[model samples]
Target chain A: MVAAHALTVDDMREVRAAAQGGRFFALFDPNALIAAIARSGDRAAFAELFDHFAPRVKGLLMRGGASAELAEEIAQETLLAVWRKAALFDPTRASASTWIATIARNLRIDIARRETRSRLSQVYEILDEEPPEQPDATLSGAERDARVRAAMTQLSADQYRVVELAFLEGFSHQDVASRLAIPLGTVKSRLRLALSHLRGRLEDLR
Target chain B: MSAVHRPSDETLAAFVAGQLDEGLALVVACHVEADPASRQRLRDLQAVQGALLDAADPVAMASGPRDVRAAGQGSRSPASAPSAPEAGMPQVLRPYGLGPWRSIGIKVAMRRVVVPDAEARVFMLRAGPGIALPHHKHSGLEWATILSGAYEHEYGRYAAGDFDEADSSHVHTPRVDPVEGCTCIVAMTGNVLFQGWLGRLLQPLVRL
Candidate 1:
């Protein structure tokens, strides 16, 4: 089981480096992983890829209020999507997170629609024009990097990890509980507290 | 920067994970354009998510677990990409004057667009004065974003760019502006639950 904690900024950089290291089998980069999955049906590459992402998918689902079981199911489904659609993984358009997020978002929409049985509703209505307005004071990519890093620094190690697991990796409350060998209620409580704390701290950056 | 209101954290979380319907998403887009605070929250959420992704440990696959890799690596024909252009307001769904508003129990002009390969569709509505839609629940997930005018549902009044999401369980009728007409965009997936005879009759017209 993966450690139930968020890595410090330096640690995160290391993991990113490992993901991009390409030294494990061949060239480092997401492209290599895509190539490996394409050229050789590389289980290792896919595993590496899964290791990096499944949690994030889980995080997204969990934050959206899916139960732990649902988050796990979604994570597995998302990984399967990554596997089946590996060839479609283009580095352009978005990074891996954006691409995966798109798939996750679509999948969630599908599940939500399926459950609701709303076939009569339209999908995305086209607007006449792209609104000229832009997001207000969007953090520069670099500033975003800095602020997030700074935010992460404020979290206690345990709280940070829980936040990471719940938000980034999509670990369901149950999953986190089990992984940490804690009670499910404890997991939920921790998550609630951690999110509350993070929300308070991140607000300062705004 | 923009006049749009940001979505609630719960909705933003859903959007970040791709859970939002298109109409709801459009409203969120409008809000993101209008509200910097919500935009920053979304960005922060995304950034934190990125950090967590980088930190996750790789799970070990069973030995000889190659079958799972087949879909990504092996020769497989791509699914047909949807023919419709990417999501933005399109003129195709525009209707001159109001057609009969079906489920919502109002007289409204309606236009629609279906995504090519994706499991989503979009609808635009222009409800006439004092019109109200039928009271119906959803068959699948549904999203409504007010583009112009305003309407009231169980959740209260929604003005242009206000978003509401409904699932199979929700039921409401958006009463058009008591005086002014209401224009809105809706994104729907799966089927719709038509509540009354009018809804049943108009059900056929409401297709994704």
Candidate 2:
């Protein structure tokens, strides 16, 4: 009997070779793959799963402002979470990116909670636990891609940099100022103005 | 239309990067949860990240085959992991650090304390009387709350219990009352550009 995940890269060599031939990969369902490997303890499936999703997870974390090292760490943690809870990969619920994004979000929350406990009394604790439920009339991935690109294009270089540093590097204004050797006021103004600009761009998209 | 308080560029960036500490992230997340306009901005930035990922050149995977290894052993369940309330206080303080104090040029002390994996640092400032912090602008968002004593900013006077958030476009000089001395906590992202001579001289030491 053929093992559920016995196919190796060698076995899929024809497909890998065809990856360069403008041939589309079969619409492999990530959830089914995750389930199959998960139930059978198939390492090959796990490796394939990691290879396909790790890059995107890294991308999301980096975009969210994690450093390359931090992003790698989060990505690893996310996959481990996936491995541990592979049964939770309900394809009907969300795409892998969305699910992974949710994982990143939760981990982010866990980290934030742990870090800011000392000053707890000073600031009101506001937990954002609501999942990013896909809206009933949500746009397709391609539409989202177009809309987001259009919105991003409108920000100024400085604004874009501020956004990138804040989200991608996770630098606070003071941290950003310290790193760039600028004044606190300047950092604040740039970020403020950048957000306003981003808002305007988004308004245009809507 | 509840003021549609948009997150400062830095705040948005930090949120996207998953760097803001828990307390602050919660604060911002609460705001985002209530504000749809703000949520749109977040989605836009996330998409930008997706595009960047789509655009980057593919890195080659490791070559040469290896023996097919068995799947790793299963991990412990959530119930097995130590609970949060059980981890003690330091785990709680993992997001905000006990920062160091440094001179802020005019008899003021300032330092950015590090918390592991945080995108932003917590700022603790202690300034004596007659110290006017340099004229500067923000690169991202800033949240400042007074802890002790009092200080006057261009916008208005702030005492204890008053929390203020400044977007990237605001500029100001903070003058402290020496008799009481001022200690405040601020969360900020992005760089600052100092305006004058003293600012230039102290630029290296007081980058934040």
lDDT of 2 by residue, A1-206 (tens): 14413654344545666686686664444555577556775566566667766666666555545566766666666666666667655443334454555555555444445554333312111212223334653444445656656666777777666655555444667777777687889878887776666556655655
DockQ of each: 0.17, 0.16
Q: Which stretches of candidate 1 lie over 4 Å from their true place?
A: A1-136, A149-199, B1-6, B19-38, B58-106, B116-122, B134-141, B166-173, B178-180, B188-192, B196-198
Interface root-mean-square deviation (Å) of every model: 8.0, 7.3
lDDT per residue for candidate 1 within B1-208, as digits (tens), equals: 2334335554565455443444445445544533445555665665565555444443322222235833443332232222443344323232112234344443655665433333545556677878766676767766766666788878787776566666777777768788767876666666443445335644677642
TM-score of each candidate structure, all chains considered together: 0.50, 0.47
Fraction of true interface contacts that also occur in model 1: 0.15
Share of the reference A-B contacts seen in candidate 2: 0.21
Each model's total of backbone clashes? 54, 54
Q: Please give the lDDT score at residue B38 for candidate 1.
A: 55
lDDT of 2 by residue, B137-195 (tens): 66766666555566777777766434457766777677776567677666655554333
Interface RMSD of 2: 7.3
